[model samples]
Target: MTKDPTLKPYQLRQLMCNSAQDICSKGYDEESGWGIVDLHGAMEQLEANYGEQLPFNDVAMDAYYVNAVNWALKNGITGGSTSTTFSPDMTCTRGQTVTFLWRAMGCPEPRISANPFADVVENDYFCKAVLWAVERGVTSGTSDTTFSPNAVCSEVQIITFLWRGLNCPDALGRSELAAGLGEHYYTDAVAWADTNGFFSVTQSSFNPMGEGIRAKIVTYLYQSLGRRQL
Candidate 1:
């Protein structure tokens, strides 16, 4: 089996800082990572807070995982590839990403009938969702009529989508959100993202245009849902 890399305390702190910043800039609430109640943190808290009295077991853990999975599934944010697994660790594809956001936006189910992308066939599950997002300016393909449906989504890319999906609400914009976030091109998007508490930057000089990872994504989503640390 492959062993996971062991990070030094300082390195782990840096990673958490980066993760927190990234998510906060995207409109999530900024909070200290040490005591933040993210999904993993929530699970650990459950174990610590109720383990002595509750019948916690693998079954319970499975139940919690399934609860999140079912919620996402019902909202069209996720779908089963097998009988009982969500494959949560798998990298999300662009199509899946768009679908997830669409569902997160209350599954608007747009009325459009045709997809702008030739590659996205009419019968494809993500066709309408992709079109809806594109038409609403929530996203644009890598090129005209070519919505790389199978491509794995990047963290920055997901943040951009989330920012737009929220209609660029009055949270923060790039210029005022953080300094040294790469070039000036993404300033507006970054500012909107920042004010909304989607992402954060530590050291007061970190770049905001960098890539995001799965942990950051999950954290941001959990925060966006206003989950508490019980």
Candidate 2:
């Protein structure tokens, strides 16, 4: 599926046979460390399953991005940047991105703590999201004492954050991961994110410092959801 970006989906039953065989052998272990399951294969399955169900009327997303947007909306992870428009190209704030992830994860409450950052008010919409990230080691503040919640999050930073939240899934099995941008600070995270379909095909550069937008971040989250399906 990685080699064929314009590919359509295969039936789920087609995947079940081999997967069931592996499960039978491995006793249904979720992290069996089996052979590399095609990340594209998982996405194609999801697209086939839910591509036509998108209810948003104003989103201008291309075909590749629609499924991810649909999945995010269907799961109540986002309500669009505006009432009707998704504004896919607009940069996402750290607070907004974290809150979107927190919502997608069922809005678990973090342990009570004193508000550590001066900017994050108790009743702010993303207050709990920031706190949860801190508590879970998903993020540390920009400085030792402050979380610039309104600041824009970068591609590499967000991917690394998501990777950490997922306990940093191994990157060795995927080809793109193994051939990542050499020795940059976000080398490993960019590798994992790329192979896992975090970045869209149009984005050729790793561009770790590039702007992380709402649509792209949601797509990464949606693709990560596919990994859980495996």
Candidate 3:
């Protein structure tokens, strides 16, 4: 809707499927790409967002993380790595992930507990974030004495944090990975994720221990924002 801002979603679907009036094919085919455009048909069919655009030069118009990044920025979750770069593929730290979630939840001040991690200093950027997370049970830290704020947050950890931040709701059904998966800290989180339509049909298993990238992190947040009250 950027161009006209008046076109409805159904009109856009019509434009995608009925715009093409194929001269070469009797029916839709892979080679024909639906058909050729019928501008008249599109004219017959026919509806508006935020600081949806980011200043990051690397971000494309069609990037999947667009809404997430925009939502994050509009709510002050991030300012990018710099004025002109989002670095969407960069690995996100545990500290950054918690901070993102904390910001998304409107930056609530921690009502209880002090910084228990020896590694987390009072002046650190993630210091308050860690405190809020600990008070809310979003995480317990890597150990009693270390927050490991700089550690690479893996995919499962991100899911677990998000789940706990929402009070660890139970899933009604088992995840597709239920049989192959063993018990772990994030098992229930993964199951809840699956119940919420987070995985694709072919995605039978997840690389839970793999590093979480900025793109995936934002995508998950965006999807959660859509599917859940949080």
Clashes of each: 27, 0, 8
RMSD of each: 12.0, 7.4, 13.8
Q: For residues 1-230, could you state the per-residue lDDT of candidate 1 as single tens digits?
A: 01224423332332233223233223222242223335454344334433232222222343323333433443345555564544544666778777777765545656776667878987888887798788777788889779998887765676667667656554433345445464553455566556645555211222444344333444344334432221
What is the C-alpha local distance difference test score of each model? 0.52, 0.67, 0.72
Models 1 onward score TM values of 0.55, 0.71, 0.73
TM accuracy, model 3: 0.73
Highest lDDT model number: 3
Candidate ranking under lDDT, highest first, comes to: 3, 2, 1
Q: What tens digits encode model 2's per-residue C-alpha lDDT throughout 1-230?
A: 44335433422322331233342223223345323465556565555654354555656556556766776776677877666677777898899888887775557688968778888998999999889888878887888778999899998878877877766777744556536556765677777776665555435555767998877788787666555644
List candidate 3 segments past 4 Å from native: 1-52, 201-205
* Root mean square deviation (Cα) for candidate 3: 13.8
Off by over 4 Å in 2: 1-62, 172-185, 200-204
**Tens digits of per-residue lDDT for model 3 on 1-230?**
65567544433553445345765544334466456666566554321132235789988877767656765665477868889998988999989999988876657677865667999988888888999999989998788899899999998899899989877888868776744578888889988877776654213346888888887777676566545320
